[model samples]
Each structure stands twice: as structure tokens, then as C-alpha cells.
Target: MPILSYLVGKTRKLGLGATRSTTYYEPAHIAREFATLDHLSKGRAAWNIVTSMNDSEGRLFGKDKHLEHDLRYDRADEFVEVALKLWNSWDKDALKLDRESGVLADPGLIRSVQHQGEWFKVEGPLNIPRTPQGRPVLIQAGSSGRGRRFGARWAEAIFTIHPHLVAMRAFRDDVRTQVEQQGRDADSCKVLTAVMPFIGGSEAEARAKRDRHNALARPELGLVTLASQLNVDLSPFALSATLAEVAESPLIHAAAAEKLLMQGPETTLEQLGRIFASSVRVPQLVGTGAQVADQLAELFEQGGCDGFVISPAYLPGSFTEFVESVIPHLQRKGLFRTAYEGSTLREHLGLADLPG
Candidate 1:
């Protein structure tokens, strides 16, 4: 009955530094650790690789100063490259059983991969053998210049938090171009964006709910947040003043929308600032089940997004309602499956068979 595997993201620290940080985990250590998780979870492991931009993260790594943006991703590229070699080190049939004469696994079947790369130099095979599934599914979360390149090259799935359709389409197109340029199949990756639901049975009810949600957000917090994003202070501006009078921005976007704001339909500076303060211009889905389903289908069909990350505004009950009520409607309409058929997440997403 377990369904809808989200990105269990971990910070990918490059270099063979001791796998420290409750905040981050190295791929080499994670590859071995996550294989065990995959074994236990019936092969549902999605590694959402994130190289953080936060300076606090740098301090955790024992660096007094933060890394340059270029260096962060440069290391990410090498980190993933080594991670793949580590994953593939154990072939699909690496574990061969020989039941007679006290034999266990065939030694010939197990081979060590001596991988030496720019950022990592792993000596041999991963501790665990090839899983029932090939490997943990790789999810990439970044929308910056280097981030997109990383996602296009390696991500089987993309976690995006886009503000609107026009921006969403541009993201898809840009990544698709990278796919074409890299000589890889464009369809191999799926882009999932974040959309929060605030169901209402009627339009008036929905609008009222949105107003209530907005009421919970203070304009000062909004102003400060917006200022931080734009790298300026908005304290000088009145809360009632038009945002354009205070600052200029084209749109709003997030990485969990997973990329910084991408160019799309124009946004008023006020509306754009609101997006930063409270996520979801209309990320709040206040509608009936049919209405919500219709919106989702429309987004998938017209917006060109493969699916949504779908965060719950509240905790357990929120996701619980979605899983129990909304998912069945989706299944009945043939938008989602009633059950999982594959062991690993990759197999679940139909990527195990993809040519590398």
C-alpha cells in the first residue's frame, strides 16, 4: 500500500572526506548505506542529490568560507560520475548462487571496479552486491546554470518548484535541449514540480481560503524575504506601495520548483514578492476532487510537467487525505496506478531498462 516516493534528498559533499554532517552525506558512503535501505524498502530508494548553496553547509565541511558557485557543481559532476561507477561496479548478475559442495556466491561473478576520477578515486566494488533492482533512482535538485547541466546529464527525475506554466515549459525546453545536445534520450528524465492543494467545493470558497492563507503571512516578513532574494532591503518601501516602485523582478521560482525563477509570463513586482513570501500564487488547490484532478491533469497535459512533488500544507492528515481520497480518483481515471508493480524505484519509474 506504500506509494508516491518523494525525493529523500541528501547533500552531496565532494572529495573523500570522512562522511560527516547530519546535514550531508557523501555518495561513496551513501551508495553503500542506501543499498541496504533499498534491500529493506523493497527497492524503493530515490537519491535526490543536492549540492547546497548555503554557507552554513560550508562551515560543516570545515571550510571557514563558502565555495564558489562554479566549484560546487564542478565537484558535483565528479561526485555523481564516481557514484555511478560505484553503483555499476556490481553488475546485474553479480551474485551467482552455486548450491552444491558448500559453495555460495561465484567469485568470478563478483568483480571489483577500480574507478579513478577527477574528484574521487574509489578502489573497488561497493560492499553490497547488485540489488534486486539495478540501483537507487537518481533525482537531481537544482535550477541554476550548473544545476541544470547536472540534472540533464544524470538525473532520472527532476524536482522543480516552478511558479507558472510559461516558466515550467521553458525549464522543460532548456533541459530537453541539453538532453539533445548530450546525445542522450530526452524522455529518460521526468520533471516533477511542487503544487500545494487547498481543496474547496466552490470558487468562492476557494478564493476565501486563499485569502485566509494570505492573511496568515505578514507583509513585513514578505518584504524582508523578498528583499533577501533580490539582494536588497525593502524596509524603505511602504507595505501598500506598488512593488515595482520598490524593486523590479520578472517572476518567482524555487529549486524545489528546483530552479531559481525562470523567465515566463510577466509578473507584477507585488505578485512576484508574494510568491517568495508564501509559496503558491495558486499553488493552493482549493477545489472539489474533480476540480483538483482536472487541474492536475491539465498541468500534466498542458503544462508539460510529468507530475508534481505535492507537499502537504499540514502534516499526516494532509498527505493522508491525498493518498486515501485523491489517489483513488486519479487511479479510476487512469492517471495513477492502484498499486506498485516494480521492486526498485527505478523499475517503478520505468528507468532500469534505460540505456546508459
Candidate 2:
């Protein structure tokens, strides 16, 4: 966060991925860290709300097992409420730094949070001053029903993974509907899809790059990863065994674990293994700059997403290629920014600015 502070005025936003873990650190600590970062960045910090998925994470935190998915999110909802009360503890006009007055701040303007809930018991105003944005932006990336409800109530933005346009559009609409049902403006929460793009000068070049990358992918590593995510070892079963043979795991993200079953009864564990091995879970665009731009524009125009979190299939090289090629095409269509117009992340994302 301190490192990101230096880039505050240079158009950078710090996104801290905070998993729910009251056993390791209290919610108050999470609130203070992000609050401090938000202050230092002058309102450019965001919290990527998450529930740690793996048993490995639980072990590292001194837990015998990870909490059930629904229970974890249950805790998250209360945790966020406490953090918000703390953030809003100080009124907007609480700060009174005046040379003429004998006081540095007005004590009466600040109030105790006094948050007592199922998961946390936080009291009083946070020691740090209020952030420039009043509160750091809340970001969420959970695709499950329970996760979506939590995001609707608290997240200012949501990150999602959808393999098709229809599903993506439906997901966006559903989330917005949920937001309205929660008595918040439907447009207040922005939905961003994670798209892995492999852009090249031409279509053939892109395919070749993807093929090369795939050939080097290790299926065993993918199984290991899937096991960690599902909290069930895939090694015990044969590659040809169907998902129905596996008993439901106690401590897994139920929605994510059920995804393999949704694929169909004929899909072998081997096929699913390859899918994860090659990172084919999220939708991928492998094409020329113009082709990639057209797809992105189509998705954006059709209300499929507010924006896309483009994850390059390969680091630096893929990123450099896209910036030099695809971004220019997007800029030409007026679908992307040609130059940044704001010093803060929220403003860049078309969010309202705080009053001075």
C-alpha cells in the first residue's frame, strides 16, 4: 500500500484482496489498513473482497479446516457492515484544520461506530482520520448466488467470470436487479468480467501463440490446483471416472464445485483437468487487434459488462502486444480512454467525486 501511495497522482489504484479470516486478524485491522491506504492514495484504494478458497490457506492461518462457503460469506456481510460504520464514524466535515482556531479537529463531529454483530464487535471511531473518498471502493469477485447477494449489498464493483455473452449478460442483469431489491441504485455497482486475451498482429499468429502455450501446460499441475480449490484429492479417482462418483466435499465452494457437474455426465475428470490445466475456465479471445476490439465492444454495447479485467494469457509479452495493438483500436471507437482525465481511481471509473 505504501508503494502504491507513491503512484496516487499518477493514475493508479490499489486493490487489496482481503479474504475473510477473523481467526488470523480481526476485521478492525482490515478496516485500518485499507483506510490508511485510501488516505495515502487520496481515495484510490479498493478492497477486493474474497473468501479464501483453499484448505492450504486455512492451515496457514492455524485452522483445521476452512469454513463452509455460505458461512464464510455470512461472516463477510457482517464484517463489511462494521467496516462501513467505522469509515462513516467521522462526519464529512469532521476535519477542522485551521490556523486561526486553537483546535486541530472538532471532537463533536466524530461519533463511535458501536458496531455489534454476529461476526464482529467493533467499537468507537477508527483511530485514523476519514479517507478522502469517505470509504475505499469495495470490489467483489464471487459468482455464486450467495456471493452475488453480498456484492449487491456492499460491493461498488464486481469481478466475474463468464464463458459466453448470454451468461455474462444474464449475470450482469441479475446482479443489478439484486442491487435494486436491496434499495440501492442498480447502476451503482459496476460489473467487470475477467477475460484472458492473446492478441497478435493477425489471427494466425494469435492461434500459434495460444497453441504453443497450451502444449507447455501441465495437466498434473491443474489437477493439483483443482484439488486445492475443491478441498478433495482428484488423485484417488481414475481419469475416466465421472464427477458423480465423487462425494460432495464438506469445505468447498459449493457453486464452483458443482460447475463440473454442469458440464454434463459424459465429461471425464481428465477432460476437466485439461480445461483447468490450460486455464480455459474464463473466456479467451485469441485474434487480431481489430477482432479483439470488436468482441469487447459487442459485449460492452449489449450490457454484458461495465468493463473487462483483461488478464493476458502470457505476462509482459501478451500485455505489451495488446496495449500496442488492441487498445488503439478501442480508443478509435471511443470505447476506451485515449488519455486519463482524473487523478483518482473512482473518477477514472466514472464514480462520483467526494465534495471538497
Candidate 3:
């Protein structure tokens, strides 16, 4: 959050997002922190809501065990409810900086939140005034059933990982239906698919760069990560054994296992592990700038996603290359903005203004 706050000072148009776990953090604290960030950034702040995964994260927060998956989402739903109440506590005209009258604010305009929910109880109005954007943009990244439900209710933008176009379109369509069921506009929530691009001057050069990057992946490390994500023990299986062989593991997450099997029942556990470690299963685009742009355009036009979340392979260089190379192609195709269209993040995303 501090890093994002610092970035707010350094940049003018970029949306500064920071993740906060609903399972671990207090609702009031999150409300105050993000409110401050929104104020500092002139409404460019965004909050990526997360219910932290893994038992290890629970241990760090002084819990004996992590809450069950669905239970975590339940808690998160209430947590966000409380945060929204606090954010909306103050009226738009609450603050009145009249020097001559000496009235800093209108006392009656600021109402107490007085929220008491299943996971949290926050009382009274927030100390800070109403934020410029009303609240920071809500972003979520869960793809499971419960996760999708929670996101449909709260998230203005959803970050997802689906390596194939069909899966991406299915997920987006499902979410849009759910959002409409909740009585919200289907277009209100934007779905963004994750992609890691290996851009070069030519397609062959890009493929070679990607292969070199993939060669450096350690299969053992990949196994460990894959085990964690699947919540199953990989130690019992031989590296050469195919995922189809272990599909019957009672401990394995069914959806995750099924997705892995989709790659190929004959694909070795080691190969799957290596793929996970290399890109965490995010789709990899290996091509020149124009070629990469074409892939993204196809996905966008096919109802697969509203946009993309570019997951870079490396740090500064990966992002720098995309900005310098890929962005120009996207701009030429009228798929990306050539310049800032608005100052606030909401405006940038074309989100409707919150009712005052």
C-alpha cells in the first residue's frame, strides 16, 4: 500500500491497486487505508479483494487453520459490506471548507455506518471525508463457483486465468449472467484474462526467448507449487506419472485436477509441474508486437474478455518491452487508448459515477 501511495505521487494517470485480504484484515482499517489512498491519488486507487489461500497464510495470522473455502467467501462477503457502508457514510457535501464561516464540515451530513454483520461490526462514520470516486475500484481474482458469486456481487473488475478462449468466454458469460441476476448491469463488471507475452522483433526470436525462459524452470519447484494450488500431495506420485493416473486422489481439488488433465491425459506430472512453474498456467503469447496484438484482439472481439492483465515474464525489461513494442500495435488497431481520457480511474475504465 505504501508503495502504491508512493506511486500515486510519482504518476498521474495510472490506477494504483493494492491487495488486502478480507480474512485477515479489519474492515475499518481497510476502509481508512484505502480511503486515504483514494484521496492521495485523486481517485486513481483500486482495491484487489482477496480471501488469502493456503493454510500457511492462516498460520501467519495466528489461526490454527484456514477457514473452509466457501466459509472464507462468506466472511469476505460481509467484510466488503462493512467496508462499503463505511465508505458511503459521509455525504458528498459533508465537507465545507469555508474559511470565513469557520465550518470545516456539515455535521448532519455525515451519518454513522452502524453496520453489524456476520464477520464484522463497524460503527459510525469514517474519520475521512467522502472520497473523490466515492470508493476505490473493487477488483477480484477468484474463479471458483463461490468466488465467482462473491465477485459478481462486489467486483467492478475481475482478473482471471484461462489458457483457452472457450474457457475464458464461458467464465465471462457465466459471470455476466450472475451479475444480471444480482440486478446489476452486465457491462458494469469487466473481465480481464491474464497473459504473459514474450515479445521480440520476430516470431522465431520470441519463441526462442520463451524456450530459453522455460528451460530455466525447475521441475521440483513446479511440483511444489502445483501441489500447493491443487491442495494435494505430489510426493507420492512419480515425476514421470501422468496427471490422469492421480486424478482419483481424494485430496485433490476436482476443478484444478480436471483443468490439468485437459492439457493431455498423457502429459507427465513433471511436465505439468514445469508448465505451472514457468507461467503458473497463464497463457503465453510468443510473437512480434503485431502478432501479439492480433491474438489479444481476437480474444476481445470473441467475447472472451473485456481486456487483459499482462503478466510479465521478468521485471522492468518485460514491462518496458510491452509498452514500447506491443502497445503501439494495439493503439494502431484501435484496441488501446493513445492517451489518458480522464483523470480518475473510474473514468479511465468507463465506469459510471457513483450516486452522490
Taking the candidates one at a time, how many backbone clashes does each contain?
Answer: 10, 0, 0
Put down candidate 1 lDDT per residue, 23-72, tens digits, no spaces: 24566786776566565555666667776655556786787756666677
On TM-score, the candidate that comes out on top is 3
Runs of candidate 3 exceeding 4 Å displacement: 249-265
What lDDT tens digits, residue by residue, belong to model 3 across residues 10-108?
A: 998999999999999998899999999999999999999999887777898899888888999999999998888889989999999999999999999
Give the TM-scores of the predictions, in the order they appear: 0.78, 0.91, 0.95
- lDDT string for model 2 (1-356, tens) is 55555566564543433333433567788789888878777767887888778777888888888887899889888887888778878777788888887677789988877777777878879887788888877888877789899899988889898888999999999999999999988888999997888777789998898888777777667778778776776777678776655434443346545765776657777777777787757788889999999989999999999999877777768778888888999999999888778766677678776543
After best superposition, candidate 2 residue 1: deviation in angstroms?
Answer: 4.1
What is the model-wide C-alpha lDDT for candidate 3?
0.90
Ranking by lDDT: 3, 2, 1
Global Cα RMSD, each model: 6.8, 2.8, 1.7
- What is the Å distance of residue 31 in model 1 from its true position? 1.2
